[model samples]
Target: MTHRPLPRPLNFAAVFLAAALTVELLDELVDGATGAAWPLVRQDLSLSYVELGLLLGLPGILVNLVEPFLGLLADLGYRRALILGGGVLFAASLALFAVAGGFWPLLAALVLFYPASGAFVSLTQAALMDAEPARREQNMASWALAGSVGNVVGPLLIGLAVTLGLGWRAVFALLAVSTVVALIGVRKSPSLSQEAPTGEKLDWRDAARGVVAALRRGEVRASLALLECANLTGDVFRSFVALYFVDAVGATPAAAGLAVAVLTGVGLVGDVLVLPLLERVPGVRYLRASAWVTAIVFPAFLLIPHLGAKLALLGLLGMLNSGWYAVLQARLYASLPERSGTVMALGSVAGMVSGAVLLGLGAIAQHFGVEAALWLLLAGPLALLVGLPRRASLGSR
Candidate 1:
């Protein structure tokens, strides 16, 4: 029998970009809005900084726990269902968050929301990978760019909404509408059907074994460790940067929101500019240079005391930081065989674990000061350097 080549990867960039933007809108509505309103929320709710951190961190914990199961389901050929279902659940969570009156209600909503987000993210990447296995690097770069665009747009939109006196609840409502629209976009896209078939049923135990086997490989392990470090740094900044601006830099809520918007917007630009250049550069060399740049720029946030100087530093940080995800993700895809869903899910799990640890550290640093928290950010790049071997042979093409 003559074998036909697979269809070229679906040009789901528009769908993916729309969905990613919606997801970011929801995320910013919940986290970014809350961060900007931290002072007001703390005063109104009579909550401590530690409690706020816990509330924010809960999503990470829930998402990590549920991701492996979602990944298993995707591998079992339910990619479309998982993606669509996640979108629905994410929308509902945002609605719940908008009306949530107390801490418990907010926490419950987050628990529902984040797992769905994780599922959607994993399945979306899997779908893209299935569509164009040969062009995995380019596609993954595009995927990262979509996320960067979302991050940029989400914060700026929410900031505008808040500035217009729409309040945080209104922001959530807008985000819910955006998610529904994105869901429609996703449904219109062609269904993906390139996953490996599971001849017999496989349990979580089987999946766990697969994960263990993958991690046991030396190069894969190194890559995972490096990714964990990157994740920790990113999560730490995302979770606390707004608070730092408000409390440490003496900025108002609107100003803090603008700072975040600027960072994300510049980062989006960086992703678009960097994607085309990846092919011309050696992946290993690019990773090394990006890592060093991140390491240097991240700590500089500590020294810049003036608001304008800090914003400038953040833009530079955004430029360097934005490319890291695409580079790392491309390397990750190159390292794995065909288990894109499984690999991406496992990577998410690693990132969540790192997020939880970083949040704990953030809580501790909150007691001391944001300065100490900045120090914690330094640990990530240092860890990345230590975990990654000096030799470049370990990374896959």
Candidate 2:
């Protein structure tokens, strides 16, 4: 009897990729849940507006100072320690959030969670890239897909908690448990121990210099620019889409909220669809085409008077740009091969600069109106058009 060969068990590499992608998903899930739960948290803690602002902004700024060094440390052969240790701290921080009595305690937990996420979640991403160098773009598409799922699931979890009359604390407590489960998966994964050689060990100072050298390179600088610019059409656009619907389109708050949902929900569908598309299309070629199409569609989205038409354009824009980050980031890693950790370090520094740009955009919005400010997002696809290499295809690995 020619029985089908027994279904093969997952090999080490496959198991490791699963664990790493789970971490990415969990990371975004926590972020989505936390953002959704914040109003409840603020009411429970009786937080002041200033405190809310601090909670939103302070931890990110503080973590930036340390995450770059953490990235350097990962390159210095501390990836496993950073990821596992950070996972423990991440769970503890969530537990802290579950029980925070006031703003200060909650702030402390936020402070801890940011860098811990950098260590556990971001390093897991780096590890995944190292695990399969030839398949970086493909693997990143999967990672991005996992994150998209997490983002969708997170808000749903909060909604479920609210429906059941369970408090936000319960949601956080559950997340902490999930974090532990993901940590165990990472800890058991054999691939965490393996790293591409990074030459002789250098002290943190030397590693910092290495990051500086990478920034000096034209390709690295361009990659950083592309990443930040891409955010304009991505997270930056999501942040303001609801407001745009309200202020620009004269939509009610309920309808505005639906705008946000459509943006994210459609983006999630795009992420799912992009995985198969990437197998057939070269990443760069697809990005170049996406950029040109988005450049046209975004302006139309702004000019179109009809709300339905605008929504259609927005969904098309989201779908068109689905593989943007996956492809761009894989190219960034390819540009600085064997230095995935350094890529992280560079990303952190670039992030700080990009964070300031958001403020500038906000200032422009306040002065010129959101629609005018959103025009700046045109820079995203335009940047891609300008910066992407002229080559038609990178050819499959």
Candidate 3:
């Protein structure tokens, strides 16, 4: 009898990719759980929409001051250190969120969480893009896929906690534990310690100069603008959907949670399909067409009266916007080339505008109600339709 073939050894590159992707998965899991739990958090803290706005927007504004610096440091070959340190803070912030008794405490936790996530999660993403320079779009699609899966799971976890009578706090506490495991995986990734592309031990001042230079590029500026505008349909939309279901659709808390899951679950399917689709079509071409369709679909989602009809439209909206982030983000990395960390820095700068938009949306929701505030989300598709290049030649498929 012939001997059996030997088992394959571990591929370090694949292992590193998995570890990096896990960080993104956990980050989105936290976001999904938070969005799904907003109603419960609101009731427990007795927070007004304005306070909710502050919680979401102010921390982001504050984090911008820190994240740009962190991004610079990452470009200077400090990525592994920054990621590891940020992971510790990320875990602590989740622990704080679990025990927060009121709005101020919750705000404090989120304030800490934002910059921590920028360092822990965003830097890791940059490292992944840097690892596979030629495959930036494809890798970004994979990243989005991992995040979409997290989005689906996060709401289900909230539902499970509520069903078990453990509550939203329990969900965050569990997330804290899971984050530690992800940190361990990242710590073991050998690829993370590589030097910057220049291979020089540069100072922060040099990194700062690099960021300044990156900002001067028109393509970089356009990408950053598109990213912020596109976000109106993403986390910004997610933050309000469950609340909208509760207030406007008159769904029960359980059903509202289900609404969040359904939206994200369909999005996960879209993310999956977009991976292969990106190889066949220029991402920008796909984006322009999707934007036009989303413009129509979003209004119908709001005007539709029946819950079933709204959910169907929500699923359609999710599918239509599938590769939005991955494509735009990949374009940003392409613009910057090997300077992925600089891309993170520029993105953080752009995120300030998004923070302001969230604050404005909150104020609008407080006065006119969530239904009116939701109309602001139409800006996402509109921005893409206006901003995406008319010809696909700007980026080869």
Candidate 4:
């Protein structure tokens, strides 16, 4: 029998993915600009490193804490409403940050902002998975590339704002506008509920059961652990890389901006290439090899002596690190076919926990030195390589 491909209109998935990326980019811009504002904020508000970590890491924690509930909501045919509400809340949070002048207000705003961002990310992934069937790998690659593009644009946009003599408050205003645009795009998106399974009310108990089920399966547990480790390492690097360049490597903020641009730009290339390569290599082999390579190449940052060399090394690291999320996400989505929404939500929880731990490590590094912290970061990939599943299948349960 001849099979016909599913109807996918006007690349709606791509458009939806792009809108999601814009929100992510705006969030990143806020994150980068706030991090840059730390020196000024520290002197003015008497902020300590612990407080800084709290401001930066708290959003992620809140997001992780709420992800499971949000995912379950999406599975119960509430995907569109959840995304719309999340977008509105995210924009409102950014707007609040625009005028928030002191420490407490900013911290409170982040608690709201992070969960909103988490809802957008988790729901968007679920929507894309629901939208595409046969081209899952390709669609996952596209989704990842959208995020990589956001990462590249976020720091660059912040650098431009800094160059224009815009205050940090102005950056938050700009992010608010971006979120509003994303909200509009999301509203125009087709309802994912049309494609979802019917008559199945998600059980609240399944959220806990999903966690227990994932842990009991060795392959699923291994993949989740690897993601947590990699995410922790990446978050720590992101948090400290700009500071390290300025204080340790003797570069200005603009120069640090350029290095970040290069790092994330190369990562975009890695993300774009993964889908095509997936056709040639099995998922497990590709993941195992990528993990090994990243482990070997990531620590090479310590060997580079000059600013240019360090920037180049960061770009190389970006290429290896960028594809990790897509590969891992594809695997997880495949592993829990009937419950992808739940599984993805749990992954977000893991990322949140890992981010909190990494933020603490980042604070320690800030007080001591980045070089001293590199040793601990090196352990992440090594642990992944050791714990990685040996199975060869892409989505084998």
Candidate 5:
């Protein structure tokens, strides 16, 4: 007898994914605007590189500390309030961000905005994973794809902001408006408990033990290390690329915006292309090979003196870098399939160190150049080469 495929379930997986994507798109637009307008912001505020890095990073400390707790709460079934309430707060924060005029207010806004949005990011991933466990890899890829779409809109939004004389604040304003609409849909949607019903109440003791246990797993260790490396490199690039375009290459702000757009736009394509291969190929192989390729292309991208040449190389680099997260994150979930909530919070924990990295990069840029600071990104591939498991499958275990 021939095997017949089971029918796909009618659930809010699609709805939740849409809400998640909307949040991502809105967040990236602001991110793109900030990066694209960095030089302008810097000049306007008469800020130093150290100040800028601190401005961008110091507010993240509180968020990082509470992240695991938030994850644990989500695992305990707070997805509805976390998603809906957090999104509205996230939107309000963005709207507040528009009115922030000086360094302190700006810092406050970052503090409020990141954690607020962090809620959406962490919970949505948990909910979506809960909603469809079997399709973890595909769902992770879809998540990235959605973020990539946001990435594209980000620079384009900034580019339009510059063209229309709307200024950087406009990006935040638009994101706030868009986020309100997204939250409305999110609020109306069925609770995640409807699919993955509430579990036992969160036990901090159990969570602490689970974390210790997770840390001991060689697979978890490897994946988290790779994630840390990936986050560093990607963060450095995102924070610096627009500055590189305008500061080093003398590109216009609009041109810088487009350059960021191109970098992420190519990444979007790469993510879409890999969704199918993810099922057929060993994720580690792709992750490893992509790492080597990105490492190779990255320096050449720096060496090339021409602005156009660098942009072309960045697109190639974007394509290579795009595969790291999907495959690595999939492998991550596969490592401890039950702890999607935990995996969502690991980045924030790792992010605790990123401020220091950004500070060092800022120092380097102040003393030498942004390109010299960017050289630090080599740590990403180096970590992959040493830490990522050599197993034939996605997870070494």
Candidate 6:
């Protein structure tokens, strides 16, 4: 007997991954730079860390708020337009960032940039998942690998930019160019074909009812809750690790950036190595194990005083945590296969929790110290434990 092939197999995975990879690189590239170069940006503008926290956190507020509407669009099967349009908007915002000279101006630029960036990222992944519903885990593993590349390259870019006096704004120009190229590839790709209608058009009355219903589902609540918890640690690590290295570890700005590179760069190994290793294992199992390992390892990472030891431990941390993104995301996408955008929007909402936590951490650091705040990141993995094997399987509802 002959077996049938996948429906025309758009085979857009390569183009989709390429476009997603470029944006992933740009996102982390700019963000990593922002974290490392904040001292300079803050000093030049005479802003406080509290203000820095606000700057980092507030723009994301609007982004998260808009995510559901964008999800509505995603459910409408407009992934192509969202992907390309969001990218151009983000690049434009980056250009504005290059010229902004003050706090309010920088804030305005980021308002446009962050939400656009969110669309570029979350929607693109939705589109990718749409393209290969069956191979989502593998595709997402590849996607995570690309993001891991950005994680490493982002800090290194910041380090090189600072060391060479190219300035943080200079990196934005390069990213803007890259974003356009990614869009070009997206325009040519076949990844955004509509498979089916996910939900009705966004009528607030209807949407409110639908959202309440989705939130009530066991799979939705468990998966999203655990994910939000896991990301709490992630938010801290992403936003503050470099600063911790600089302020607490007493490393130079450049060295701190390199240290962050070590943390994220080694994650490449995790994404790559875990793909095949966990192929037979369920996504839920991998996620719970990763959460446990991260919780166990973090305190040791903090207590160690030697820079070399911390870096080595960070490498280990990166490896273990690397597969978590893909695996967790696959679980979420599988849980609600049709509502890709809506589910993703809910995930983006989960990320808004970070802004609040980050603000609180900033306050804690301001009063107590940055080191004290870094300790708060352990909440991420500990959260994973609470939701752990009360764990949501795809069919766990």
Ranking by TM-score: 2, 3, 6, 5, 4, 1
Top model number, lDDT: 2
> How do the residues 1-397 of candidate 2 rate in per-residue lDDT, one tens digit apiece?
8866443235656788889988999899999999889888888889999999999999999989998888888877788899999999999999999999999999999999999999999889988887787778888999999998988899899999999999789999998999999898899875665353655666777777878898899988998899888888998888889889999889999988887788788999999998888888788888889999999999999999898888888888778878899998988888877677898888888889888988998999899999999998999999999998877322234
lDDT of 3: 0.86
- Which pairs clash inside model 6? none
Per-residue C-alpha lDDT of model 6 across residues 218-306, encoded as one tens digit per residue: 97887787666666555457668888899899988988867767766677777888778666766667767777888888899899999
- The TM-score of predicted model 5 comes to 0.80
Model 1 bad stretches (over 4 Å) = 1-54, 101-105, 162-166, 188-191, 197-205, 238-262, 295-311, 363-373, 382-397
Query: Whole-model Cα lDDT per candidate?
Result: 0.68, 0.87, 0.86, 0.69, 0.73, 0.74
- lDDT value for model 1: 0.68
| Candidate 3 C-alpha lDDT tens digits along 1-397 | 9976544223655676788889999999999899879999999879999999899778977899988888888888888899999999999999999999999899999999999999999988887877776667778888999998887789889999999999999999999999999999899876676576676777888888888987888888898889888888877998899999999889888888778777778888999999889888888889998999999999999999899999889888878878899888988987876677788888877777777888899899999999999998998899999988987643447
| lDDT for residue 113 in candidate 5, whole number 0-100 | 77
Ranking by lDDT: 2, 3, 6, 5, 4, 1
Best by TM-score: 2
Cα RMSD for candidate 3? 3.9
lDDT for position 93 in model 1:
86
Model 3, residue 148: distance off in Å is: 2.0
Of candidate 1, the 10-residue stretch with the lowest lDDT total is 388-397
**lDDT for each residue of candidate 5 in 1-397, tens digit (9 for 90 to 100):** 9976544443456666677666666666667666666776677667788878887767777778877777666555565777776788788888877777767776777787777777875676666665666666677777888777776667667778878998877877878898888778667656444222244555667666666787789888787778768875565687788898888778899988778777777878888887787777666777788888878888898888887888899888878877677667777777766566677666667666666778888899989988778888888987887776677554422
lDDT, candidate 4, 1-397, per-residue tens: 9977554554665576566556555655665566556665566678888988788767665667687777777666677787788888888888887787677887887888877876765676676666665445666666677656655565556567668887556777878887888778778878445323545565667556666776688767766877777764565566667777877788899998787667667777887777678767665667678778877777777667777778888887777776566666677677666566677567776766675676678777878887677657777778767766677555522
User: How many angstroms is residue 290 displaced in model 6 relative to the true structure, after the best TM-score fit?
Assistant: 3.3
Report the Cα lDDT for candidate 2. 0.87
Residue 151's lDDT within candidate 4 is: 56
